[model samples]
Target: METVTISPKYQVVIPKSVRRQLRLVPGQKVQVIAFGDRIEFIPLKPARELRGMLRGLDTTFEREREDRA
Candidate 1:
């Protein structure tokens, strides 16, 4: 895991390796989520770009016949 130091201005620079791996570009928006004791940065993708992202995935699920109504 790459470690980063938080600057005195409360900003942290993402490591070059991590940034390149994630294809992160300057000025790109990211959502910061605080879960438990860790933080997660989720890239904000355009809705159109998310189209067909789950193509051919297993969507089958068991359900009672009555539930179909």
Candidate 2:
């Protein structure tokens, strides 16, 4: 297990090994979720890069439009 110490500013550095494993880069945004006593970090990509993944979903665009309509 890896351990990191939080600085006085309440900021903790994600270690090199962890950064490499997660492919995290400087200025990358992460979604922080608080689940009871534990916290989760989820990486977010630019919306444009996610277009293909959204297109691949089984739901059709018309179905989504009708639901929202």
Candidate 3:
């Protein structure tokens, strides 16, 4: 795991390797979350980019009769 130090301005610069791996671009927004003792950053992708992301997935699953609405 890579480690980063928070700057005096309360900002941390993401490493180039990490940024490239995540396909993070400048001006892209990320959602910050504080979970337990660690912070998490999730990239916010545009809705258009999500199109066909789940293509050809096995979505056929049986549901119980009572579970049907």
User: What TM-score does model 3 achieve against the real structure?
Assistant: 0.79
lDDT of 3: 0.96
Give a tens-digit lDDT track for model 3, residues 1-69. 788999999999998999999999999999999999999999999999999999999999999999988
**C-alpha local distance difference test of each model:** 0.94, 0.85, 0.96
- What candidate 2 gets wrong by more than 4 Å, as runs, is 54-69
* Per-candidate alpha-carbon RMSD to the true structure: 1.8, 4.1, 1.7
- Candidate 1: tens digits of C-alpha lDDT, residues 1-69: 999998999899999999999899999999999999999999898899899999999989999999987
Report lDDT (Cα) of residue 19, candidate 3: 99
Stretches of candidate 3 exceeding 4 Å from the true structure: none
The local lDDT score (0 to 100) that residue 56 gets in candidate 3 is 100
- Point to the candidate with the largest lDDT: 3
- lDDT score, candidate 2, position 46: 86
Candidate 1 CA-lDDT value = 0.94
Which clashing pairs does model 1 show? none
Model 1 Cα shift for residue 44 (angstroms): 1.4
